[model samples]
Target: MPLRPSRDVFITCAVTGAGDTTGRSDKVPVTPEEIAAAAIEAAKAGAAIAHIHVRDPETGKPSRDLGLYREVVRLVAASGVDVVLNLTAGAGGDLVLGSPEAPLPPDPAGTDMAGAEERLAHVAELRPEICTLDCGTMNFGEGDYVMTNTPAMLKAMAARIRELGVRPEIEIFDTGHLVLAKWLKDQGLIEDPVMVQLCMGIPWGAPDDVATLSALVQNLPDDWIFSAFSIGRNQLPYAALALAAGGNIRVGLEDNIWLAKGVLATNGDLVRRAVQIAEGVGSRVLSPAEVRAKLKLERRW
Candidate 1:
């Protein structure tokens, strides 16, 4: 497919990811109040959506606690921000196997696997406008850790999200994952105007390169609404790349923490930078209302 540049683009600010990034940067929001504030700040800075992942308040580790998610959602909604909320349903899928020497039993402390329904507990309760659905399982990170999302799990999760009238942002980490997303659509598990996120440049997932991104885009269904993002240093560059490729953009501390070398960034700062890139390229930055209307999202508060 040829590159199709969009004149109007919507930016999604991923507030705080579930990575072990809190120790590396103090700007990562650890508490519900902090996460909510960061999301609201991003909205004010022109992010159409805020993608959130809650962390343990004291230890700053990834957490899937319902109460924590509830508190964060409540605070953000109460703040009266116009940004669409996108909570992470990609948690609770960590699978850290034992060392190669002893690979029979998985490491209990490292493993965080759960049923599909358990993973979407927060989504079911809070009913955010958007939630993510990782399309495939792969060898994630170094060592034996795998991001497990089996076919059955995804089907069940997709059905539940559709029932709840929440849009599932199908996160495709590689070409095969994109293929699986199309299959799911054929099965009628996903709704019309399907939303997808081409997650590039993760350690074991797709690489951050032009050829790879172009191939991914070529495989996308014509009717789907898509966005693309890259992690770390590639985050800023991909903002314009996605827009130029006829897709939306995503940025924030979740993907990259550095605004420049040795400088950490806040979620708001990342959103502001993305705004400059989109507007610099003659594309208008879209608001939450515009995104919701474009995507046909239901804002269930």
Candidate 2:
């Protein structure tokens, strides 16, 4: 495929990820109400889509409670925000080992492995327009915590996502993850115009440099709608890079907490910065309806 930059773009705001970010930043949404408010704020600012994850209201820990998800969905719908909803199915794959010397049994405190159907329970009920599918398993960071998504598990989830008429945002963390994505497509699991997310600057994964981003963007199959974003300080800059790389943009508290050198950012702030970056470069910011058409998302709203 010839290199073509995206002049028409849509921004997805990852309101509050399941990461341990609540204590670091007060702006990071914890409760369902706060999370929905942040998504609504992003929508009001300029985001076309809100990528969601629910957390425990009391402890502010990441949770897979169906009731919590329902509350977030209800709040977002009630807020009258016309943003496309993208729920996460990456919660139950966390595998924290007990020790390197004896790695037989996983740590019960952190490990949250579950069956494919259980992992996607929220997605099945909420029926969001989009949900993430972490394409490959990798050591999440400097620890025994492995983000495990085996081949069999992935196929089962992909098939179910297709059956539900909800688009799966294939999350490519490393180069090999992209290869796995192609394999999934070849297996006739994902549909045409596949929506992909090139996650960059992650530990033990792909770097956030222009060369790495460009290489991945270039390798993407023709007609695949991709969005790219890096974590931490690179998150804001990745917006411009993604627009330049013929892709869409994703930003919010989930990826980064800083709005500037020392200032903390809300999801709305990150989204506004992304909007400025997109519009400043002459890219037309797409709306929710336009995103639905471009990615062929089944509208739940």
1-301, model 1: which lDDT tens digit per residue? Answer: 4768989899999999988889889999999999999999999999999999999999999999999999999998898887899999999889899999998699998799999889999998899999999999988888899999988888888899999889999999988899889888999999988999999999889998999999988888788889999999989999999998899999988889999889899998999999999999999998899999998997765
Q: Please, what is the TM-score per model?
A: 0.98, 0.98
| TM-score of candidate 2 to 2 decimals | 0.98
lDDT agreement with native, every candidate: 0.91, 0.92
| Cα error, candidate 1, residue 240 (Å) | 0.9
In candidate 1, position 194 carries an lDDT of 94
Specify the poorest-scoring 10-residue window by lDDT in model 2. 1-10
Q: lDDT, candidate 1, residue 113?
A: 93
Show pairs that collide, candidate 2: none
RMSD values, in order shown: 0.9, 1.2
